[model samples]
Target chain A: MNEGETRKPIIVLVRPQLGENIGKAARAMLNFGLTEMRLVEPRDGWPNPSAGPAASGADIVLNRAQVYASTADAVADCAHVYATTVRKRGVTKPVVTPAEASSEIAAAQGRSAILFGPERSGLETEDVALARAILTVPINPEFGSLNLAQAVILCAYECSKHEGLVQPTQEDLLPPAPQEELDGLIAHLESMLEPKGYFRPEARAEATRRTLRGVLTKPAWNHLEVRTLRGVLSSLQREPRL
Target chain B: MNEGETRKPIIVLVRPQLGENIGKAARAMLNFGLTEMRLVEPRDGWPNPSAGPAASGADIVLNRAQVYASTADAVADCAHVYATTVRKRGVTKPVVTPAEASSEIAAAQGRSAILFGPERSGLETEDVALARAILTVPINPEFGSLNLAQAVILCAYECSKHEGLVQPTQEDLLPPAPQEELDGLIAHLESMLEPKGYFRPEARAEATRRTLRGVLTKPAWNHLEVRTLRGVLSSLQREPRL
Candidate 1:
């Protein structure tokens, strides 16, 4: 198995009824970098046309999905298995949150499988009995309903946090402008305000300048940004050219 | 405002095009215990029929969603407003992840708001200018596409972690039974196992019994649960036929 495959926990769908829901689950998985999908007797069967539209463009998960006849077979090769269910069964087992489970999965050797039950009824007692641990979240008491996609997203998101995923849109921020540049900017603003009588009443001039400095320093302005802002202030002080 | 309304952060949707995405975003918010959704000039108007089915049954969010003519109006009362955007608009501002933003929102005084932009274009530079900070996430560099609902879930999930929402599925774990009751449980189990010659060999018996005590005491079983376990063990020792 490749690094991506080994690192990611297998999302095992046990007796999923709807192809659309499976697709949505796949979409949720891919959003967090989880790609391997295992289907245990999907009601609509694999390669369903309905799943594609719901999956959007997460074709990698769907194309690589493996089908099995039973939940046991799906997770047989895995050393760690976590059954995703809210209710507690008669059997005694360690309970964990998705965050805790993902952390364990990250550290554990061999393969790990996270089992998600059918959409409408969730996991049966028999399905949960096979797992080493039960994974659950604290949800609203009045409305405890969570769709398949939402459930998958919650677990996948926790797993994603531990991985070194790159933040594509994150801005490469420049360091804060030097103290001299900031002082210059503050002095220029004070100079413009002086003539406008904005600092009026000599007694309050010191207090007013302090307040102005506080506001300007709130944002850690980069050197380039400070320069641009100074240019704007200079333009405001001078004559405007068409 | 009620405690619920005041403590929770406001979700502002700026220029949302489709009703389904709005509904989906609302669903994500409610899942994480957030209410109070503010819409800034939703395209195709409010009360769109397409939103209901898509929301899956998060009626409270849809019912109480407030609409504003502009982003300014939506966040007018908010003391801390975070703009959810990824692009660098040549502006200086503090950038924070959803987890960081939610933590700050949780600690902030007065009301706070999280602004999400449109589907195709995301937040405009002018729209982002009004925010106190920029909220963003580390996404896939090659494919940095996040749907409206997905983005909402990312932020909402982080915020929800702070709220003490009831997990209906969570076991009603009573506090560890009082010390007296726990001692009785250990004594009773030891008495029951004594007769069956379960603790064989005098030398190893004490060690084995200690191990048994350790195992029984691990789960912080409540008083009622202890009593139930005692009853189960008693019945197991006494019965042969149904």
Candidate 2:
């Protein structure tokens, strides 16, 4: 899909053993606005009461979650799937960070799922084989295991950041210069710098274009100031003697 | 190390179970420019033959690794230590993702290390007790085990990205305006707008400084041009026209 379409990640819980963990994962998913879920072999009943309270207000994930016996069934319609693991499991598939995976999932057609395994054993080695890439969390070597719900939260949070749900603290707040103004500024700069030999004969035009882009992209110049600068350049070009 | 000096992470493998995995971890660490490695209780001899072949030129990590017996001893001098795990080991510390962990680690003082565990049982519960915070990696629920070395690579990579290794994409590369030039510009701008009452007497100096800083920081004004503009302003300030 194009940038205009709203994108979300599908959280697939494979062989979840604890009802509370499932519920907690649901709650975490909702905390980041992720509701879609697919369940593969949940040991405890999906609608158990323990799950409801643990889910907080995330009943939506529980309500819409799809259940299956195998991971392949859950991700049948998914174009992209990532297997979560704390160990290598000897798979040769490409691995991606949660942020990268979210962007890929968002860009792909059809459904996508980030698969999770049981709390005790997690997914078997065979289960990870179905995924296109592996998702590994970076933790302390002394104690690297993470809670099931926590993993869900981590992925969900990364996906949310990638999807622009939260504004980054260091991002440039100013909007980029409009195309029309940028084009005019480029032309004006080229005309002025051309006579100054800023560009050699062979790569002159391309080099000039590159410099113009470099200057304008600095503060993302706005329309009025850009026009004023262009006017100054035009005047200079006309009155070469001055 | 203080905040400024703690931009990079010290990759630590605590009680690493396998030699090949250590090499693989080193390889991953190299991909992201992380060279430091601290080993806590390696099951196999470090700099093992198997590890070198597996490292694939991440020999820097292997060469620089410092080995210790206990996890606590390994990170004794570290101001911050994070344990990696797929499940919580009953530690009562804040849980943070590698991204968040890196930011905090970057701001912390003294050396830091992220601990990983042995292959079979992962990090011991006691080992996790020493960490100031717990790091959680987001993975697929169904396939949650990560290889020991892969874990090292992922965390190191994320930490490196925030430490200024990845330059900002903005194109302006002009030498920054000097402090004196910037000071002059601030003085000039304040005088230029003074007649219009842009800055009142009480807040004039502070407001002028802030505005100048904001504008100059945006485009990273050049030293020569800023002085020229300031010179023009000085002439205008001397005009004495109401």
Candidate 3:
């Protein structure tokens, strides 16, 4: 684990019944870079074969999991704990959404633990009693059922924001094709359309081409795509080959 | 379908090839109260039995699923069309996250459609060209593999927030326990822990109790949970009982 991983909150599953659910929870945690998993009395025991396939590729979480006899023991050393639940659960602690808790956890000193209850009923009162704060999201009351993995992913996703995890969409991508290439592509399309009557009346040819340009230029096609489209037009011409 | 469901954005799956993926997307949409689904040129044909089990219980989405010959035909009536994709795709349309786009779709004057591409490869240039804007999520650079359901859920969850969908945690919630009950509960635990030397040295006892009170009061437990805990305490004081 890296320094960030060491400082990240540990996920504690209290009496989780299904090995598949545990595996999915593991997958969700690792997706956001949280790998420390503490299992409190997993029903099928540790190293359940059913988990590996379901986890897809989140093996590190399952391998590094520490089993604790109880929820309190699992989070004994953590300075803060957030218990997730669907109901009010009669706990009088501060109610926080996952986003709110994630920010606080990022800024908090020492270790933190987030508790998830079982798949069927969720965290019991005793389990919730151990948390420093209740982390419950506003969800459909009639169908307040968020599968274990969904809940974990939501929390992990929020937590990931503060970790500065890499974002593909945020990268300095290759810029749109050079102006000349775009212009060439437009000219090529116009030439092809001119004989096909796509431009229609000679009086409206300019305006029609402008609208077509607006449609074609809207997509920030890269150089390669422009080349590919030019190639496609060439193939459609007389005897041209790919 | 509910009244608000009529105004909800239509989900358009363009050139989707897999049945299971379509099913899962349907499930995600329904989870967030979205049911309208339009498929453009599904390779496996419509009404694939394979979709039923994977959809879990989102039959309404399946039942109402519409098939279209092209993306344009699918979204022809939509005033706003947001296409989801990771790459820039040479599309110069304005980009927005699911949350930002959901808000706009909610307030827009006419019908809105959010298009998702296939599982193997996202929308083609022609497919994306039909959109008025782009809707994509910020994801990991190295592994931008978000399955169909996960992507659908992110956008649907955001839209649900704007739809004012019923929230279990927000409604019919029992009021927080009265201050007197909270105090009594604190005292009850203190009384129980006192003789066992739970507070430890007299010098730190006050601080310990203060911390305990903080933990107990943070959950915002309702009267029901307070009573249950008090019953638990009463039971602990006597013989063991269920």
Candidate 4:
């Protein structure tokens, strides 16, 4: 298996009633980089041509899907398995929310599977009994059922987040100027402002320098940012210093 | 100032051109911990009683807001100021998304300001010059104009998340071990596992140590858990070396 396969969660659709739902599930899985797919006794054609378009660019999942005669056969080798259900069946397995399930699944870091049952009737008692855990998404109790694909998408998002598959967030990526560049910019700025009444050379120059450095280093600077300030300082030399 | 006051961000309405926009800005600022407000050339009454209702629980921001004639005067005392604008001005200052800007502000461990431009004309060139950096919100270019309050809310949300005030929805707050303790655990784990052929005696142990450290450093285990594991190993050592 490739790195992506090992890192991602395997999505198993057990006894799905429609090809479109399967197709949409594939699309949702792909949105969050979950490509592994296992299908158990799909009511419609397993490789329906119509399912391809609905899958969008998630063709890889549809193309490489595994067909199974039973849910047991689908997840026989999975190290961890979670059954998605809305109603409680009084199963002995540990019940978990999607958030908790994702946390546990993230820690597993091995062959893990999430099983989604058919649209009309979810997994059979025997099918759910096979799971290590039962997972239920929190929704409005009055009308809580989510579409198969939407459920798949939410689960996938949670799993991807566990693996840190999301892009580098704006917060994580800082743009503070480096020490060397900042020192240069500060010196240049100080020299230019010294001639103006902005800094009193006797007592306030050091104080002003500290204040300037504090401002410059307040936020982390990125590569282009340091260079931009250097350019601005160089330009200021050609203009009025004060 | 209270501890909360010291921790929150400063919301600066720079050259804001509307009363309703200012009201909405106050509402957004209140959603997060940002209560400090500075208004620079507001088009309408800033301390206007009409702004009270719109501010919701953010009445303090409006009540204590300082009015100024120029953005420079408004932010003169602030250690770090970020000018917010929608369009890309020719000047090359470090531009950050609201999220990045917030984290930067939060980490400064001092007062940091987020500047917003007027709804009609936005900030002027000189106003942008007054700031150390620029904060930009990524929106759909076709319909880029955001409501003033919505923009403030976005900035506030980012700021709150960075300040450790808002709980993370996806991540577990794994308490970090002190440097000395973490180093000791790393050594203990290495010693315990080395005898089991986990690391070859002759090979460089740095890579193996790093991999093990990475796993242990994950949110899965706390410092106490690591200590317990060490006790388990010491007790197990009483048996056969393996």
Candidate 5:
């Protein structure tokens, strides 16, 4: 295999139930250029007919998938193994986000594999023990309901980024306003606040001015945004038209 | 609404098909803490019967989903509009990944909306024209097949990263060993190399030593790793057993 192909981490599904979900996971893997799949003791056995239709044309992933008798066997050749879990486990293994795992996997010297647990109940404690780290997706703590396929897709998507996917160009984003324009906007605002006694209390006036400057500077508003803010200040300064 | 709620981008499904898919999309959105959903003229009409069961308990999103007559009307209140497309279109709008769009939406001064096209067919030309930018997930060029729910989930997942989700801590990771330990390893390796005339040629000895140090310094191995290496060197120096 080529270096690029070898560098791609293997996706290992441990004790996955439901042929349809397996197929969905395959589809998710293929969507992000991940082709290797390893299955460990599937409940219904292999060659599940239901998986084909759900895979939606990602048959190649299913066709060449390897089956292992145990999770340890599945990751025997891999030097780095990460077990995915939704909840914080009692284990002391380092936890990482999918994005962070992808970066580490990319730089890893040897083969790397990510293990995903079954749908209903997640990975057994024994399965997690074989892994060097835990990979967790930081989701809404209140509504964390990521399915097997969704988890696979997210990990696959992040790994694809390191395979030379074209990054979205930032040319469309306008540069932050030049210093002079920002100064002008600040000066305009200060002028308005001075008359209204917004910066009153002569003893603390300097500190108040500095605080306002810090808030204005933090946004790094673009030239157009600065211009818009200037216009708003001018409008507010106008006499209300009855 | 509070600033956090206001900053969250609205997810708009334009001319969606299959009530089941709509329900799935709602589940996907709520998984990442996005509560607002807007639908524009769903194919089977609003309150689809198939949607509820497929949502998998993301009923809050489906129940609160707002239906609109047209795509334009759905995003009328938004200052920034992004239309998602799998393929590159003829439009000149800036194209961005989900992560980029999330960052922009988080920092935007006003409401932002991301539009997802229908299942079978994507956003129409008119819908593309209405958007300030195009949101595209960089997928496997050879096999691009992202279902509506998958697409929604990916975008939602990226947005959640900026919502103060507890980051996976790196406390388990050991810090790099102290410089003195690193120097000891280098010294031991150098002692072995000097006796073997590994750094031959007096003129180039300093340069070769520097190059060796560079390679060794890059990894910043921890104390345990350094100790392990020292053990390896000690083993190599042992006399071969008959």
Candidate 6:
């Protein structure tokens, strides 16, 4: 694996219940370039038949997943451990958002692991005690219902930002039209408006002109867009061909 | 709805296939405080029976969701429209990440809408043409397997960050123990270890002590933790009660 991949945090599901949820979690991890997965006493055990179909072709993550008997054994080699929890616990540990924890994991010296609890009950107090800090996703106060896979995807998504994932390119977007072309379009419209008595009230004409200029300038239309607008003005000026 | 809720971007599902996925998307949206959802020709039609069970108590979003006949009609009242797509398209619109799109939506005047296509096939070129910009989540190039709900959740999660969602409180954590308390705990451990020849070879004894000290100091144990460690050491020094 490359250096960036090595730095990626391992996703550990502590006592996860359903096989399908495990598969979904695997899909979520691989979506954002996280591959390593450790299962701490999964309820259905590993190599479940239901997992393959739910994984939706993310078998690599499931194939390489390691099963551990306990949470402590799962993160024995990790330098940093973060427990994912939604509700406020009475435990005394530093709580960090997924964004905060992801950045820290990216810069950490040794391997880091994020622990996710089971589908229904969430992490036991003893399980949470193993982590140095808590990772929480700030949700709506009235309604906070993030499923296991959803939580994993959010963390993986944030972590991908630090991995230097290539963003969608804007190369297709052309530069705005030159000043002369824009002036020409403005003049063409003014000429049409002049005969229609649009500027009849000369006292407020300058203000109206300024407002029109602001509306046109805000879009910063490229040459093609400018040409399209010019064609539109020409069509309006023409006698109905129909 | 409050000002922030009104300003929140509407999530438009275009020609969605499954009712379950639609319900899951609603749950995801509500988790991040997004209540507005618009459906454009769902395959099973509106009020699918499967939606309620899958929503998991996020009925508010589903109840208020508006149905439209076409993509254009769905975003007719919106001032800004963003299309969520995974693949690179030949379209020349500006492409942005969920983070960028959320921030823009948060600050934009008038209403904004984000369009998500069907479960199997993504946005048709014609559907995308109605949008002002394209929003794409940067994922693992080799393994892109984000489900419909997963995609909606990521966008909602990022948008929630701009909504001032309250972070998990760290009030439960106490400050690190005072220097004297830590020193006492270290000294107590050293006294026990000294008798066991743990600091062997006088020439390297200071280095060993420093390493020990470094290990203990890294955690920055609070006052209670230090006392607990001291108690453990004292207990170890005693004879086995059993």
lDDT (Cα, tens digit) per residue for candidate 1, span B1-242:
68545757889999999999988887887777777899999998988787877777888889889888988678766656788876555544667888888777665545778889999999986677666678877665444557888888878878877676432332443444543465577677666555545555668776565444434433335555667555444543442331
DockQ of 6: 0.18
> What are the TM-scores, per candidate, against the unseen true structure?
0.77, 0.41, 0.67, 0.46, 0.71, 0.81
> Which digits, one per residue and each the tens of the lDDT, describe model 6 over residues A168-240?
8888777889989989888887776665555547897886677556545655777877775575556445543
Per-prediction count of colliding residue pairs?
A: 1, 46, 20, 6, 0, 0
- Every model's DockQ: 0.06, 0.04, 0.03, 0.02, 0.14, 0.18
Residues B59-117, candidate 2, lDDT per residue (tens digit)? 76788888987888888878888988877656678888778888887777677788888
Residue B70 of candidate 3: its Cα lDDT? 93
Docking class of 4: incorrect
Q: What is the full ranking by TM-score, best candidate first? A: 6, 1, 5, 3, 4, 2
Spell out the clash pairs found in candidate 1: A167-B138
What fraction of native interface contacts does model 4 preserve? Answer: 0.00
The numbered model that scores best in TM-score is: 6
Give the interface RMSD values of the models in order: 33.7, 15.6, 34.7, 25.0, 28.9, 35.7
Instruction: Provide the overall lDDT of each model, using Cα atoms, as 2-decimal numbers.
Output: 0.76, 0.66, 0.74, 0.66, 0.83, 0.83
Shift of residue B187 alpha carbon in model 1, Å: 78
Provide the TM-score of chain B versus the true chain B for each model in turn.
0.66, 0.65, 0.75, 0.64, 0.72, 0.67
User: Considering summed lDDT, which 10 consecutive residues are worst modelled in model 1 chain B?
Assistant: B166-175
Looking at model 1 chain A, which ten-residue stretch has the lowest summed lDDT?
A: A233-242
Q: After superposition, how far is residue A153 of candidate 4 from its true place, in Å?
A: 2.9
Which residue segments of model 5 deviate by more than 4 Å? A165-242, B170-242
Tens digits of per-residue lDDT for model 6, B9-79: 89999998989999999999999989999999999999888888899999998999899999878876676
Kindly report which residue stretches of model 2 are placed more than 4 angstroms away from their true locations once superposed.
Answer: A1-242, B1-6, B168-242
